[model samples]
Target: MNKPEDAPRAFQQAWNGHDMQALGDLFHADATFVNRFGRQVRGVSAIIEMHAPIHSTIYSDSTLENELISVTPIGDDAAVLHSWSRLACGPAHPAGPHVIDTLFQAVLTRRDGAWKIIALANVTLADPRTGRAMLRV
Candidate 1:
Protein backbone atom coordinates (compact mmCIF):
# COMPACT_ATOMS: atom_id res chain seq x y z
CA MET A 1 0.00 0.00 0.00
CA ASN A 2 1.21 3.53 -0.72
CA LYS A 3 0.00 4.90 2.64
CA PRO A 4 -0.85 3.57 6.06
CA GLU A 5 -4.53 4.47 5.80
CA ASP A 6 -4.74 2.58 2.53
CA ALA A 7 -4.93 -0.69 4.43
CA PRO A 8 -8.54 -0.12 5.49
CA ARG A 9 -9.75 0.49 1.95
CA ALA A 10 -7.84 -2.53 0.71
CA PHE A 11 -9.42 -4.59 3.47
CA GLN A 12 -12.87 -3.36 2.55
CA GLN A 13 -12.35 -4.31 -1.08
CA ALA A 14 -10.79 -7.69 -0.33
CA TRP A 15 -13.59 -8.56 2.09
CA ASN A 16 -16.30 -7.34 -0.24
CA GLY A 17 -14.75 -9.46 -2.97
CA HIS A 18 -14.45 -12.43 -0.59
CA ASP A 19 -10.83 -12.84 -1.63
CA MET A 20 -8.91 -14.43 1.22
CA GLN A 21 -5.60 -14.41 -0.65
CA ALA A 22 -5.84 -10.68 -1.18
CA LEU A 23 -6.80 -10.19 2.45
CA GLY A 24 -3.83 -12.21 3.67
CA ASP A 25 -1.45 -10.13 1.61
CA LEU A 26 -2.32 -6.99 3.57
CA PHE A 27 -0.87 -8.15 6.86
CA HIS A 28 2.53 -8.98 8.25
CA ALA A 29 3.48 -12.60 8.83
CA ASP A 30 3.28 -12.12 12.59
CA ALA A 31 0.38 -9.74 12.58
CA THR A 32 -2.27 -9.64 15.28
CA PHE A 33 -5.99 -9.04 15.08
CA VAL A 34 -8.90 -8.71 17.49
CA ASN A 35 -12.31 -9.11 15.90
CA ARG A 36 -15.51 -7.32 16.72
CA PHE A 37 -16.61 -10.43 18.55
CA GLY A 38 -13.51 -10.02 20.75
CA ARG A 39 -11.71 -13.05 19.37
CA GLN A 40 -8.00 -12.37 19.21
CA VAL A 41 -5.58 -14.03 16.80
CA ARG A 42 -1.98 -13.82 15.75
CA GLY A 43 -0.09 -14.55 12.54
CA VAL A 44 -1.21 -14.04 8.97
CA SER A 45 -2.27 -17.64 8.41
CA ALA A 46 -4.23 -17.69 11.66
CA ILE A 47 -6.01 -14.52 10.68
CA ILE A 48 -6.87 -16.03 7.34
CA GLU A 49 -8.05 -19.24 8.98
CA MET A 50 -10.32 -17.38 11.33
CA HIS A 51 -11.80 -15.26 8.57
CA ALA A 52 -12.09 -17.72 5.72
CA PRO A 53 -15.05 -19.72 6.97
CA ILE A 54 -17.09 -16.69 7.83
CA HIS A 55 -16.95 -15.40 4.28
CA SER A 56 -18.55 -18.61 3.02
CA THR A 57 -21.09 -18.72 5.80
CA ILE A 58 -22.48 -15.72 7.64
CA TYR A 59 -20.80 -13.21 5.38
CA SER A 60 -21.31 -14.88 2.03
CA ASP A 61 -23.42 -12.00 0.78
CA SER A 62 -21.96 -9.32 2.99
CA THR A 63 -20.31 -6.14 1.80
CA LEU A 64 -17.94 -3.88 3.71
CA GLU A 65 -17.29 -0.18 3.27
CA ASN A 66 -14.60 1.64 5.20
CA GLU A 67 -13.93 5.31 5.74
CA LEU A 68 -10.60 6.39 7.17
CA ILE A 69 -11.01 8.45 10.32
CA SER A 70 -7.41 9.35 11.02
CA VAL A 71 -3.82 8.39 10.38
CA THR A 72 -1.25 9.13 13.04
CA PRO A 73 2.36 8.69 12.05
CA ILE A 74 4.67 7.45 14.74
CA GLY A 75 7.73 7.61 12.54
CA ASP A 76 8.80 7.39 8.95
CA ASP A 77 7.98 3.71 8.95
CA ALA A 78 5.29 3.27 11.59
CA ALA A 79 1.76 4.64 11.83
CA VAL A 80 -1.66 4.15 13.40
CA LEU A 81 -4.88 4.36 11.45
CA HIS A 82 -8.50 4.45 12.52
CA SER A 83 -11.43 3.71 10.27
CA TRP A 84 -15.17 3.25 10.42
CA SER A 85 -16.78 0.38 8.58
CA ARG A 86 -20.34 -0.43 7.71
CA LEU A 87 -20.90 -4.15 7.37
CA ALA A 88 -24.07 -5.24 5.66
CA CYS A 89 -24.55 -8.89 6.44
CA GLY A 90 -26.44 -11.34 4.26
CA PRO A 91 -29.46 -13.50 5.05
CA ALA A 92 -27.11 -16.33 5.85
CA HIS A 93 -26.17 -14.58 9.06
CA PRO A 94 -27.71 -16.25 12.07
CA ALA A 95 -29.41 -13.05 13.03
CA GLY A 96 -30.58 -12.52 9.48
CA PRO A 97 -29.68 -9.65 7.14
CA HIS A 98 -28.56 -6.54 8.96
CA VAL A 99 -26.24 -3.58 8.83
CA ILE A 100 -23.67 -2.96 11.54
CA ASP A 101 -21.25 -0.13 12.10
CA THR A 102 -17.77 -1.02 13.28
CA LEU A 103 -14.67 0.77 14.34
CA PHE A 104 -11.21 -0.50 13.44
CA GLN A 105 -7.87 0.67 14.68
CA ALA A 106 -4.78 -0.59 12.91
CA VAL A 107 -1.11 -0.27 13.57
CA LEU A 108 0.88 -0.45 10.34
CA THR A 109 4.51 -0.34 9.44
CA ARG A 110 6.32 0.12 6.19
CA ARG A 111 8.32 -2.92 5.17
CA ASP A 112 10.16 -3.10 1.89
CA GLY A 113 8.44 0.12 0.85
CA ALA A 114 4.98 -1.32 1.41
CA TRP A 115 2.68 -0.63 4.32
CA LYS A 116 1.27 -3.66 6.13
CA ILE A 117 -0.92 -4.10 9.16
CA ILE A 118 0.98 -5.37 12.19
CA ALA A 119 -1.91 -5.15 14.62
CA LEU A 120 -5.59 -4.41 14.32
CA ALA A 121 -8.54 -4.15 16.69
CA ASN A 122 -12.17 -4.18 15.61
CA VAL A 123 -15.23 -3.26 17.66
CA THR A 124 -18.92 -2.97 17.06
CA LEU A 125 -20.09 0.54 17.52
CA ALA A 126 -22.41 1.00 20.47
CA ASP A 127 -25.49 3.10 20.81
CA PRO A 128 -24.58 5.63 23.48
CA ARG A 129 -28.13 6.04 24.64
CA THR A 130 -28.87 2.34 24.99
CA GLY A 131 -25.35 1.07 25.75
CA ARG A 132 -25.95 -1.69 23.24
CA ALA A 133 -24.54 -2.61 19.88
CA MET A 134 -25.85 -0.36 17.15
CA LEU A 135 -27.52 -1.59 14.00
CA ARG A 136 -27.79 0.82 11.15
CA VAL A 137 -29.99 0.96 8.12
Candidate 2:
Protein backbone atom coordinates (compact mmCIF):
# COMPACT_ATOMS: atom_id res chain seq x y z
CA MET A 1 0.00 0.00 0.00
CA ASN A 2 1.64 3.21 -1.19
CA LYS A 3 0.85 6.74 -0.15
CA PRO A 4 -1.65 8.75 -2.21
CA GLU A 5 1.09 10.95 -3.63
CA ASP A 6 2.68 7.95 -5.32
CA ALA A 7 -0.33 7.16 -7.48
CA PRO A 8 0.39 9.55 -10.32
CA ARG A 9 4.09 8.75 -10.22
CA ALA A 10 3.34 5.07 -10.51
CA PHE A 11 1.03 5.71 -13.44
CA GLN A 12 3.70 7.73 -15.22
CA GLN A 13 6.22 4.95 -14.75
CA ALA A 14 3.79 2.39 -16.13
CA TRP A 15 2.97 4.58 -19.11
CA ASN A 16 6.61 5.27 -19.88
CA GLY A 17 7.26 1.57 -19.76
CA HIS A 18 4.38 0.91 -22.16
CA ASP A 19 2.89 -1.60 -19.77
CA MET A 20 -0.75 -1.62 -20.81
CA GLN A 21 -1.85 -4.20 -18.31
CA ALA A 22 -0.28 -2.30 -15.44
CA LEU A 23 -1.71 0.94 -16.74
CA GLY A 24 -5.19 -0.55 -17.03
CA ASP A 25 -4.94 -1.92 -13.52
CA LEU A 26 -4.48 1.65 -12.24
CA PHE A 27 -7.99 2.59 -13.36
CA HIS A 28 -11.15 1.93 -11.44
CA ALA A 29 -13.63 -0.56 -12.87
CA ASP A 30 -16.00 2.24 -13.79
CA ALA A 31 -13.33 4.72 -14.74
CA THR A 32 -13.61 7.09 -17.70
CA PHE A 33 -10.96 8.61 -19.94
CA VAL A 34 -11.12 11.60 -22.25
CA ASN A 35 -8.53 12.83 -24.69
CA ARG A 36 -7.92 16.10 -26.45
CA PHE A 37 -9.36 14.58 -29.61
CA GLY A 38 -12.79 14.58 -27.95
CA ARG A 39 -12.77 10.83 -27.52
CA GLN A 40 -14.22 9.36 -24.38
CA VAL A 41 -13.58 5.79 -23.24
CA ARG A 42 -15.45 4.42 -20.28
CA GLY A 43 -14.84 1.60 -17.86
CA VAL A 44 -11.63 -0.24 -17.08
CA SER A 45 -12.36 -2.97 -19.62
CA ALA A 46 -13.14 -0.50 -22.36
CA ILE A 47 -10.05 1.46 -21.42
CA ILE A 48 -7.97 -1.68 -21.76
CA GLU A 49 -9.50 -2.45 -25.12
CA MET A 50 -8.90 1.09 -26.31
CA HIS A 51 -5.26 1.02 -25.29
CA ALA A 52 -4.41 -2.54 -26.32
CA PRO A 53 -3.86 -1.82 -29.95
CA ILE A 54 -2.16 1.46 -29.15
CA HIS A 55 0.26 -0.25 -26.80
CA SER A 56 0.94 -3.03 -29.23
CA THR A 57 1.31 -1.02 -32.39
CA ILE A 58 1.96 2.68 -32.07
CA TYR A 59 3.50 2.88 -28.61
CA SER A 60 5.45 -0.32 -28.77
CA ASP A 61 8.70 1.55 -28.35
CA SER A 62 7.53 4.96 -27.35
CA THR A 63 8.84 6.84 -24.35
CA LEU A 64 6.97 9.23 -22.09
CA GLU A 65 8.58 11.85 -19.88
CA ASN A 66 6.22 13.29 -17.34
CA GLU A 67 6.36 16.35 -15.12
CA LEU A 68 3.78 16.24 -12.38
CA ILE A 69 2.50 19.73 -11.68
CA SER A 70 0.29 19.14 -8.72
CA VAL A 71 -1.74 16.64 -6.74
CA THR A 72 -4.66 17.95 -4.76
CA PRO A 73 -6.45 15.68 -2.39
CA ILE A 74 -10.23 15.83 -2.52
CA GLY A 75 -11.23 14.12 0.69
CA ASP A 76 -9.50 10.93 1.77
CA ASP A 77 -10.59 8.79 -1.14
CA ALA A 78 -9.86 10.98 -4.15
CA ALA A 79 -7.36 13.38 -5.67
CA VAL A 80 -6.79 15.43 -8.82
CA LEU A 81 -3.51 15.50 -10.73
CA HIS A 82 -2.21 18.05 -13.15
CA SER A 83 0.79 17.14 -15.29
CA TRP A 84 2.74 17.70 -18.48
CA SER A 85 4.50 15.07 -20.53
CA ARG A 86 6.83 14.88 -23.46
CA LEU A 87 6.06 12.04 -25.82
CA ALA A 88 8.60 10.62 -28.19
CA CYS A 89 7.01 8.33 -30.71
CA GLY A 90 9.20 5.50 -31.87
CA PRO A 91 9.76 4.23 -35.38
CA ALA A 92 6.75 2.00 -34.98
CA HIS A 93 4.38 4.93 -35.09
CA PRO A 94 2.29 5.22 -38.22
CA ALA A 95 2.32 9.01 -38.18
CA GLY A 96 6.10 9.05 -38.53
CA PRO A 97 8.67 9.79 -35.89
CA HIS A 98 8.16 12.85 -33.75
CA VAL A 99 8.16 14.19 -30.24
CA ILE A 100 5.51 16.33 -28.61
CA ASP A 101 4.46 17.59 -25.21
CA THR A 102 1.00 17.64 -23.72
CA LEU A 103 -0.68 18.83 -20.56
CA PHE A 104 -3.11 16.60 -18.70
CA GLN A 105 -5.42 16.48 -15.72
CA ALA A 106 -6.79 13.40 -14.00
CA VAL A 107 -9.10 12.52 -11.20
CA LEU A 108 -8.04 9.54 -9.12
CA THR A 109 -9.86 7.65 -6.47
CA ARG A 110 -8.74 5.30 -3.75
CA ARG A 111 -10.87 2.20 -3.91
CA ASP A 112 -10.27 -1.06 -2.11
CA GLY A 113 -7.06 0.40 -0.63
CA ALA A 114 -5.61 1.13 -4.02
CA TRP A 115 -5.35 4.31 -6.00
CA LYS A 116 -7.15 4.15 -9.35
CA ILE A 117 -7.75 6.68 -12.00
CA ILE A 118 -11.40 7.66 -12.30
CA ALA A 119 -11.33 10.30 -14.98
CA LEU A 120 -8.59 11.66 -17.22
CA ALA A 121 -8.48 14.54 -19.69
CA ASN A 122 -5.63 15.90 -21.75
CA VAL A 123 -4.71 18.57 -24.31
CA THR A 124 -1.61 19.31 -26.30
CA LEU A 125 0.59 22.23 -25.37
CA ALA A 126 0.51 23.62 -28.91
CA ASP A 127 3.28 24.04 -31.43
CA PRO A 128 5.13 27.29 -31.51
CA ARG A 129 5.91 27.16 -35.22
CA THR A 130 2.47 26.56 -36.74
CA GLY A 131 0.44 27.42 -33.64
CA ARG A 132 -1.24 24.05 -33.93
CA ALA A 133 -1.97 21.35 -31.42
CA MET A 134 1.00 19.01 -31.15
CA LEU A 135 -0.34 16.11 -29.18
CA ARG A 136 -3.78 14.55 -29.03
CA VAL A 137 -3.47 13.20 -25.46
TM-score of each: 0.94, 0.85
Each model's lDDT = 0.93, 0.79
| C-alpha RMSD for every candidate | 1.7, 3.1
Tens digit of per-residue lDDT, candidate 2, span 1-137: 15546655777788777777788887888889886676899998887788778878988888887777888999998888888878788899988788878777888888778877889887777777997866644
Which TM-score value belongs to model 1? 0.94
Per-residue lDDT of candidate 1, residues 67-127 (tens digit): 9999999999999999999999889999998889999999999998989999999999898
Error of 1 at 63 (Å): 0.2
Clashes of 1: 0
Candidate 2 C-alpha error for residue 114, in Å: 1.6
lDDT of 1 at 110: 91
Candidate 2: segments with Cα more than 4 A from true spot: 127-131, 134-137
